[model samples]
Target: MTVRAANAEALRRLLAAEPVLTDCVSAVEAIGLEPGVVLHAGPPIGWQVMCAPVQGAIVGALRYEGWASSEADALELVARGGVRLEPCHHRGAVGPMAGIITRSMPVFVLENRAFGNRACATINEGLGRVLRFGANDETVLARLAWLRDEAGPLLGKALRRSGGIELRTLMAQALQMGDEMHQRNVAASSLFVRALLPSLVREGTGAALERLTDFLAGNDQFFLNLAMAAAKAATDSLLGIPGSTVVAAMARNGAEFGIRVAGCGARWFTAPVNTPEGFFFPGFGPTDANPDLGDSAIVETLGLGGMAMAASPGAARFVGAGGVAEALRITEEMREITLGEHPYFRIPAQGDRGAPVGIDVRRVVTTGITPLINTGIAGRKAGVGQVGAGVVRAPFGCFTAALEALAADDG
Candidate 1:
């Protein structure tokens, strides 16, 4: 079969997979993660080259793992190679900004029932001085501890008891409710709470339960990471299809942006990261923003986040797209670089057209159009939380490189 044909078939299987949130487990127990191991977002990079947020997050992970007691100790350990830093994507996982995953952290597990594939993501710690944003101060540590002690275990029990939440179902519903399942997850988060409220209430009592409920209620973007895991589980199934050009993943680590092609195995094509253009929070501006960061772009990989923009007019202003028309333009532009429209994720504004899916490197390079991503902007300095939100385009060089490699193989 032709590479394009194979890619189309692979994407069909990917979009067909129905991922379900089945359980929650510690990174250690679930993925056999161990101490002295830190998983960050994007391609594998060493400590010396890591961006500030990533470096800060690694230090936080070290402290969380009890391998270091202070920022100085963490710095010394990382600089001296006392701990190993790997990409979360390499470990069947996904994370948001900095995307730090540690052994003791609890991760939500999602399984693609159609193909029996699974992927996981760490629970979202809401905005403001959060660890994922590179803050490792006492407040951050205390919040992580509270989640470890109360939320994770309780949610695990509730999920197992409820027989799991159907993630794709939530995604379909959420798209209709104005959530692209990335930058905006208000609907998905609410739906998740609605689905689990009974289980949460039935399985517990008092402050622990109240805290979990409150956490879910307060974090509007709680379901974004879950959507990313679901997308990862679905797309991972498309990997290893010889001749297929479907992109398996796209991620960035402040310093670089990278992508993995379906037929390219583990190889990564990387380029310098691009700064996102968008609005900033109070006292924050473009100068203070880190280059695009996070594994959450997995959502866009599956055709939701930015590609579903026309369906999510409510999210436009927040991500720098001024209005619905601008959002539609972004989504329309993506269709040119993608293989086809998604079969399930429909955009109402586009007359129920499927969201664009299957990023094609050849088309991307030929058109000089990269995938669009809507994301949170972390502060450039370590330890500062999210400073703004915006839209970014994956660097064109990554696609050109991937296209060149594919051309060489085809010959």
Candidate 2:
């Protein structure tokens, strides 16, 4: 028989229990209500000062919504402060990549009735020339149109017919398929393709099917953002828990990298953001990379991305293709500051033990082991998109100050 306890402590343990997938869904669920909802990039921003990626998405959205004839016209309205700019999380949504969510766009909706909340995120249409990454070229705009007309409707209909796919199941399986669920998603992408096939096949085959296959094949990193959204869904549930020291979010916005600790509520401790070291596509080099940006940090909260480096040996190219031993060593160092092993994702080499579970505030304070981040490098200058990708660490000063503040609070 299962033992029951009556107390806040018990509740904390219980709430933190359940598979990671459940927690991930909870974050997505927290965002509530409807399509056509405009989710912006970065923190809450006024109508003015929206970044390029978000701006690009907004422009595409105008076209998607039949509100504007061209991006130039769309820019005029956005500049004139006509359409609304809202936070994605506020509307039960999350955006991966460039993270621009607009109303009328089809989103993968995850609902948690137990908590009376829902989370939504736009589909990952694979990589390149897509709006999320700030690609708003004519071809990109045309593809977005096709997605809204062909891909979106067909997939949305199939999803609706199937009554929605559970993301937790996909998360659980993806880890096994070589997805760190944050930095790498090869396995998750495969699993997503498999789960989506039956439904996709039913939507009927033609240029659409061919397009779908090509989309999946072309964009290998598609599911990382989805998993990050799901992870965001999960970690957000743990927010505002009384006296808990868990971290709710960790992210960067090109200018700064920051994190939130559960015990302190919504305060963020940020460090001067640094550049990533990654292998670029042909003709690209270190000079091309941009400093990291975006809010898809929900990945780190789930214990992948930089936390599960051992799972992503191939990530070295971005982080500095040094050696597998160095990669293993970096992942192992994560244990120095982590709390426990993730009950859901287990490292194959660790005798199937769960991947390093939590990032402990105490460990950070005591050991001063800042977390490592493997990220794509974007150009510092605007409009360059991604120049490279690689690994970097949380600026030590950020952790030291945050830890010091936490210590003072306890004292």
Candidate 3:
């Protein structure tokens, strides 16, 4: 089959994906994550070479799991190979920056009803000093414990009671309401809360309910993890489509950026990650920013994050990506490298045009336009948490290499 035909088929499968929030459970239960084994975001890397934020997250996870009594102990344990590290993507999951998932952590499960595949992601821990951003303080661990012990179970029961939330519809509605489902998810988070509130009210009571509601209300990015899981499930459905050059995943490990092509199976093409260029938090600047990192790029793979930028001019401005004109330019440029537009994820600002989808390595290499990712910037130092938010391009090297691999596979 021609690459074009294969890519079309892959896009069709991806667009047809129906990811739903089926459950929330411990990572061990949801993904069969073994004790002593933890998943971090992006392509696989060992403990020694992992970025400080990822290492910090691991240390935090070890403490949260009670496998280590202190940060020093956690470091020692890792040095001794007492802990195992794997990429969340390898296990059908995704997470944001320093995306660490421990065995006991509660993970949201997304099942692709159309494809019968599932993906999972940990709950968002709000903003600053969170585990995902490498903050390992007692406070961070405490919130994680609350998520696992309280919020996870409650959300799971609510999901079951509501017969699971259909994410595609919700995401579409969110796009229309000014969410690109990556850097800015305020509308999506609100809609998600609304969808679960009725069921959540039916499932919990008193202070617990109040706290959960408060947390949800406070975290405008709470829908991000859910969206990541949904994206993972949808994109995973496009894997291994013979002759397809469509990018199935794009992720960063802080140290490296990687992409997996549908035609090339699970093989990854990687390059040095780029530091995101955008506005930083108070007291932070370019020197304080880490390279782009996160499995959240999966949303872009499914054509909803940066690919849907035209749908959220506010998100563009918030991430220092300029105004509506720049947003429109970015989305239009994205179309040059993608196979088609997402049917449901339309941009109202662009006359309700569908968001570009199906990143094609051939088109990227030919056009010299890499995929733009909307992402959070972790502090260069571990445990410092998020420093800013911005846009970064998936390394052009990754796409060129992927294109070569696709050619070799076809040959």
Candidate 4:
């Protein structure tokens, strides 16, 4: 291994590309849902990740499906042997909070034409203790119903009318506006709202219009999930890329940490999950934090999240804000280890260069640096759920294994 860096043009050819987005049916197979199928994560979970917001969301979904009389029944069914829990990602979907995605839920679909793989994610619930974060209560449930009955249909109608929102441009815009498009999506959400306004206004038939206005008025985080989904969809391109040592995805549950490599297909290399070290909410400390959950880390691998931490200093409060200079340095440091840079997510601070791209296992092994993850903290005690969110680094062992695997394959 050598310490030399490639020239700019060489780096450009080595990395810098965008994946495509397509419909789930045309893109993904067997694992994805058709129009009629609502996917559920059965057992094991027991809604243990069940925070109040998520419980309310699950109950709302059950209610929406006409399967339960009230939320009480929904909870009862979830607790007993009645209902099934499913990972939204399994069915070509991603959700926020409990991220319980339903079948009819309109999803943003992305395809990797180069590799013949695809990924999907549900829209974000925006900020607050929304159901995606596992918050269950009247406030959370009512909001869920409104999104289902009002926002969901209206947005779908708008998309139908206005063709569809092109995610490529949106992601590019988000990067310049200080979003890595994964952990930090403020700018992307604002842009998405602006893009959807015309359709929302057109579909505003009395109640729909009123709901649309209300949702937009208060919800700044609305587009986060879409941004994450799009990133997830885009990064899937690196999957199955032969001889490439890029890090495609990084995710964790409270129990384990995992990484998927470009050369390894879908097989996950996992390590024991560790507790995150950073700031916490008032009245809560390290004791309240859960390990980690969700597939959102895909955004980081795509050159967002902590990698683009330079763009969003305000993100520090949410994840134990680092010094401004330190944040900026962090993003710069990532290039030493990454395999490529994102084609769409360019950083203004970097003179409009795309954000540091695909993570190279070889680069990481050679440089001895691990990936940094900024994640939401879930409570280990279940029911309580979501203590706070913060930036944390992934264990080096995870990357080491991935590098070794990629190296062995090269031989």
Per-model root-mean-square deviation over C-alphas: 1.0, 4.9, 0.8, 4.9
TM-score of each: 0.98, 0.81, 0.99, 0.80
* Tens digits of lDDT, candidate 1, 287-348: 99998899999999999888788888778789878888898998999999888887778888
Per-residue C-alpha lDDT of model 3 across residues 143-199, encoded as one tens digit per residue = 999998998899999999999999999999999999999999999999999999899
| Cα-based lDDT for every prediction | 0.88, 0.61, 0.91, 0.62
Better of 2 and 4 by TM-score: 2
Query: In model 2, which runs have C-alpha deviations exceeding 4 angstroms?
Result: 1-38, 45-75, 83-87, 112-117, 380-384, 396-411
Per-residue lDDT for 58-170 in model 4, tens only?
A: 77666655567787887677667566565554554555545666654555565544345556766565665555555555665676666656666666667666666667778
State which candidate, 2 or 3, has the greater TM-score. 3
lDDT by residue for model 2 over 1-411, one digit each (tens)? 111111133234323532222212222233443343456644455545444555666777677667788878887877776677665544545676456765555566555433435455666666546676566667766776676567666766566556556666677667666666655777787877777778778875888888867777677776766676666656566555544556666766555666766655566777766666666767788766655566666576667777777766666445674555776777788888766676666666545666665566656767877777776655544335566667776666656656666656656
Best candidate according to lDDT: 3
Q: Candidate 1: count the clashes.
A: 0
* TM-score quality measure for candidate 4: 0.80
Candidate 4 local distance difference test against the native: 0.62
- The candidate, 3 or 4, that scores higher on TM-score is 3
Superposed by TM-score, candidate 4 places the C-alpha of residue 69 at a distance from the truth, in angstroms, of 5.9
For model 1, the stretches where C-alpha displacement exceeds 4 angstroms are none
Query: In terms of TM-score, how similar is model 2 to the real structure?
Result: 0.81
TM-score of 3: 0.99
